[model samples]
Target: MARDINTKKLKKNAFRYSKVRGETASRIRIPGGVINAKSMAKIAEVAETYGNGTIFVTNRQGVELPGIALEDMPAVNKAIQSIIDDSGVNQEERDKGYPASGTRNVVACPGSRLCPFGCYDTTEFARKMDKMIFPNNLHVKIAFTGCSNDCGKVRMDDFGIIGMTEPQYDPNRCVGCEQCIKYCNIRSVGALSLVNGKVVRDTDLCIGCGVCVAYCPTRAWTRSKEHYFRLVLLGRTGKKNPRLAEDFIKWADEQSIMDIVKNAYAYVEEYIDPNAYEGKEHIGYIVDRTGFDEFFKWIMKDVKLNDKAEVAHRIYWGGKHYDRSNNLK
Candidate 1:
């Protein structure tokens, strides 16, 4: 007898329906892509016991345990409670597994904690962001990269938070080695030039990637004390249209970003298509339906940007619109 399953409930509980009959995969949330060894051991234990001993890693820095029986979901949930507790994921009920899976796992790169080019602590910020927005049923994706290198591939997400550092130049320490100038041109935007034996940066052209600061051999260029970010918006990968994110704000503060993301939830609630599949839709699509001005109005509600922040008045995205025409240009 085929077991009747409520697919909706199965997905809501973070369990993926498997192609094999009576089998499902359990999705585990690992915010910031960091997990303690103990939690990992627990996950392994569950996989060996309930699943077919396969742990598949996801692009969003999460893991999926496949080949578990549908009837064993309860046991699996009870077993993974320790992992959930260890990961500090926000849950509505104890031992019930994840409350919702619409909001995908918050992805992040190993920032200043491990990487030399990292501008900020990517793991810490990713965990904080997850705490703020997880257990949500909205179809939203957010990713954080340590620096402009974008090791986390943030641009593909709905909200891409890239770390930035204002390069602080000390003229007294400069020796005119021009290493900063050399690397800036090679690895980043050519924004640095030599004038009167001193490197001068083109403020307008600079993207705050900190290539100069990293390549400066004479300690002339240093990173700013205050952490900054570049917030990119509306990047998505779908059959209709796939595109990279565009810059929404530069030199944005952390609090302002958080507030903006929170406000976006409200915006989605107001404008999201009620008939959307399972009452969920990507924010980019909603923004497409409503004007960018309206989205800006909602996301910027009561959000105070930093003095150095630069916001785009309007945004136009370029991507392959499969919906319009499938013919290759």
Candidate 2:
């Protein structure tokens, strides 16, 4: 098969962001950022054999091989076959090469796999999402954070999946040590208090951060049966209008999250203008051009949120659209 090496389609083969003429950077997708010692050795070997001597660690928890000659990409691809296979980043097209890269890499915090305060398995979910969404050119970004700490910096991505945990309190088992209350007051949203010598939790103020569950020494605070996520959307960093994402789905389920993301690509295809911006159009800009209601209608088409899922009733975007007027100073 002819390698999809066109500058426009270079992403399909993980070659993008040109450097000097005749050279481009090849991004290696490390799904869920779980590169083991063996994988590291493999990457080092590829870099030494087919690329520049050094590899750049991407913020998205992936690797980038810079200074690769365009002509050498074929040999480079062959050299890193084992490394790519181990990462399973090519799940969509398992024939040996990447299918596409517009979805970019799926990022996740060191979740329950390593972090003490992590609520869920971020790496597992990240890889799963990657398998489903990648190998296509959708120009989308997604991130997963194990807890409210948001170590993965989810706010900058188009889709942010935050782990949520409903804390259950048992008054009888409470020793009134006030540990949960103290932790909540100082580290969390201050959703806990003491009344009548018993600890009380204000459910309305709770952000499902799981801080109380971890701080309770008496085991009075526990995780609720529901395993849910808070889905935020439309975040972007661009020259025209830069802004953080807004909350879209609260207490969302895994299936609904997937549906909304899959639908979003379809929405983009209908409204996108290939030549509108200098390059690919960020989804945020697309939403801005089309009214929110219209954009919402497309993504939510036939999508049924979970019974417990809460959808935002209204969406508003606020950002400065840079123009000559703003730069006229």
Candidate 3:
């Protein structure tokens, strides 16, 4: 007869079953990844009663409680549900679950809602994005930041959103000060002290980082009258390769934002194989394998390009290159 297999012993060792070893785990989702005082207190109470009296804060703004008995899972879930419901907050959403190994994670920074340098309200935009544009089965992490300061770490996500401000020049007000030229690190601005007592700039060099606009004391250099946010796609920072996101769309408003996100998701759904799990679960990987131009064409098929003036303002950073000829215009 074959040797008796120690099935019971094997099962006990193979799976960390809470019933056999007496442990449990629970995960909670915080919408927009924000948790308030009442939610914290309720979570603490649940942990005290059914768990190990401790909680773990996840990178994606989730809360986890571990080391509880198997019997406590239902009670813990119920308690958390009640707490969330009583607080008049609905935390139950299908796409909010944590990914097993891929990159369908969403991260956001405190945009204009809280930060001073924020060009637009990142939080509000993120919430909108979470609602309509998230991928159904695509495994890609997305991140959003209100400004280029990148407090939200958008550079690390597969898809990212960053804020930008464009500079405008009032030729009449420019006093031929070379301050903007001196401050620009990108050399986007060139200053010439003409015999006519005026300074000029070469607009071609402007990359629009906004260094000179912010430093201008006279406020002669101004950002575009209509300030909007820009979205960057296909960025990744990891061991295999590290890279910064490139600007794909400029001067995107709420409607345009929705269009862009939806189109991106649609493209991913069509082109990417649902079963393939090669390496990174980010759009950047797809872009690398294929090409960004192809992806852009797919998503931006019907989208109309913003005017050159609008586009110019969206990419402008402050510098002293006002055209005196158009002072009145």
Most accurate candidate by lDDT: 1
Q: Superposing all C-alpha atoms, what RMSD in Å does each candidate have to the true structure? A: 1.1, 2.9, 11.9
lDDT for each residue of candidate 3 in 1-329, tens digit (9 for 90 to 100): 33343433322211123443557556555535555788789888877888789987877665667676655554665677654453233234322222122334356677657765566666666656665543244566667776666778776665677776667777678776767767664343443233364445455444444566676778877766655666666666554455666665656655665676678777776667555654225665565556756776776767665563233212111222233232554
In angstroms, the error of model 1 at 257 is 0.2
Ranking by lDDT: 1, 2, 3
| Candidate 2 worst ten-residue window by lDDT | 90-99
Q: State TM-scores per candidate.
A: 0.98, 0.92, 0.66
Model 3 steric clash pairs: 103-140, 103-141, 167-316, 168-222, 188-205, 208-317, 213-318
**Which pairs clash in the backbone of model 2?**
none
lDDT of 3 at 97: 23
Model 1 earns a TM-score of 0.98
Q: Which of the two candidates, 2 or 3, achieves a greater lDDT against the reference?
A: 2
Better of 1 and 3 by TM-score: 1
Runs of candidate 3 with Cα error greater than 4 angstroms are: 1-25, 31-33, 68-73, 82-105, 171-225, 237-243, 277-280, 288-293, 308-329
Report lDDT (Cα) of residue 91, candidate 1: 97
Candidate 2, residues 88-157: lDDT per residue as tens digits? Answer: 7754444335667777789999998998777788899898888888777777889999877788889788
